[model samples]
Target chain A: EPEVTQTPSHQVTQMGQEVILRCVPISNHLYFYWYRQILGQKVEFLVSFYNNEISEKSEIFDDQFSVERPDGSNFTLKIRSTKLEDSAMYFCASSPPTDTDTQYFGPGTRLTVL
Target chain B: AQKVTQAQTEISVVEKEDVTLDCVYETRDTTYYLFWYKQPPSGELVFLIRRNSFDEQNEISGRYSWNFQKSTSSFNFTITASQVVDSAVYFCALMDYGQNFVFGPGTRLSVLP
Candidate 1:
């Protein structure tokens, strides 16, 4: 089965540095989303992207965070400046443009900022 | 505000034992969706099931079953004859028509052999 895939399975960056996490959603899917989970915490929604634009974002998705579907398959999340709290497992998910509401997720990218 | 609550923070079961994970949700929207996902030690979120508010049907697939109760606003999952491979943190999530996805703190299930 086709699945969402993310690049740089693990990333380490210095605090205050910019980082980009990339994802290639399932082919033919329409809606895309980004979520994060701090160690030992519940997954928190960051933002949702559709039609190459942000559809919705959470309070945690402040000015430091931005998402782009620079190409047909590549969807990327950029953090303008990483904070220690930004260290977490970032996941990408996509749902097909259908009546069903299932959103398939990718193996997360573990971001570690020091 | 939409919220999902997984009351059981962790559960331990012997191999071949049946385990049930409890989930309760709070949502004001008349129309919404519920979902369950499993995160193994490797930390990948695997979609297990999805149910809409209108459908209160109980579903069974292999050793897995789901109970959706709109009256109590609960969606519970059960694993029958679970194996060691079933050990993982399972999360229950809710999403309203407005597309706000809220996840509950996951229940970590440890199936011992």
Candidate 2:
């Protein structure tokens, strides 16, 4: 089955450095999302992207966070000046239609900030 | 704001036994969607079922069953004659058209062989 895929399975960055987490959503899907899960915590929604624009975002997705669909296949989440709390597993998900309400998720990228 | 709660942190059941994972959601929207997902050791979330707020149907697929109750705001899942391979962490999710989603803390189930 076709599924969402993410690059840089694991990343380590300095506290003040920048990091970009990339995802290639399932082709033909219209909606894409980025979610994060702190170690042993619930998965938290960060932002959703559709039609090259952000649909909705949580307060946790503050000024430091940005998402881009620079190409037809790539969806990226960039964190400027990573904080220690940014250490978590970031997941990329996509859904074909909102009617079915099924979003397929990718193998998450583990981001570690030191 | 919407929230999903999975009260049971961990459940232990023997292989060939039946188990249930409970999920309760809080949403103000009359129209929303509830979902069940499984995350095993592979660390990938697997989609299981999706139930809208309007549909209260109880569905069954092989050894897996889901009960969606809008009245109580609960969507529960049951596994029958579970095998050792069924051990994993199960998560329940809720979402709407806007793309924001809420996920429960998850239930860790262990099927002892």
Candidate 3:
């Protein structure tokens, strides 16, 4: 089965620095999403992208965060300025345009802001 | 508002035993989807199963099974004869038809020898 793939499985960065997390969604899927989980907390949604544009975002997705599908095969999440609280595991998911199809998730990028 | 609650924060079971993870959700939308996912130590979210509001049928797929109760607004998962490899965090997600996303809060399960 096809799975979403994320690069740089783990990243340790200094606070106030910028970081870009990348993901390659399934070949034919159109809807993409970004979610994060603090070490012991629930997974939280940040943003959703469709047709190369953001369709929805949560309050947690503030000015510091942005997402881009710069190419047909690559989806990226850019954090302008990282904070210590931003340390968490970031996951990328994608699903077919059909409402009933299941969404495939990547292994996730573990971001640690020190 | 849409919410998914996995009340049991942690569950410990011995090998060869059966375990059930409880998940209760709340959503007013007439059309929605409920899903179960597993995240082992490797931290990869594996899609386990999916069920829609319109289907209340209980489904069993080998060692995994799910019970969907529409009236009670609950979707529960059961694993039979669990092995140590089953140790992982399980998540329940709710997705409304009108929305473009899913809401998840997971339950952690530990299998002992």
List TM-score per model, in order: 0.94, 0.93, 0.89
TM-score, candidate number 2: 0.93
Best-fitting candidate, measured by DockQ? 1
Worst 10 residues of 1 chain A by lDDT: A97-106
Interface RMSD of each: 1.5, 1.9, 2.4
Q: 2 or 3: which has the higher TM-score? A: 2
Give the lowest summed-lDDT range of ten residues in model 3 chain B: B97-106
Question: What is candidate 3's fraction of native contacts?
Answer: 0.60
Candidate number with greatest lDDT: 1
Better of 1 and 2 by DockQ: 1
What overall lDDT goes with each candidate model?
0.93, 0.90, 0.89
Error of model 3, residue A111, in angstroms: 1.1
Candidate 2 colliding pairs:
none
Model 3: chain B TM-score relative to the native chain B: 0.95
lDDT rank order:
1, 2, 3
Runs in model 1 lying further than 4 Å from the true structure: A98-100
For candidate 3, write residues B8-108 as lDDT tens digits: 98999999999999888888899998888899988888878878889899999999999998878889999999999999999988878766345556888
**Model 2 spans > 4 angstroms off:** A97-100, B96-100
Per-residue CA lDDT of candidate 2, range A34-112, in tens? 9998988777889988889998898799999999999999999999999999999999999886543678899999999
Tens-digit lDDT string for candidate 1 (A1-114): 999999899999999999999999998999999999999999998999899899988889999999999989999999999999999999999999983367899999999999
Evaluated against the true structure, the overall lDDT of model 3 is 0.89
CA displacement after TM-score superposition, residue B50 of candidate 2 (Å): 2.2
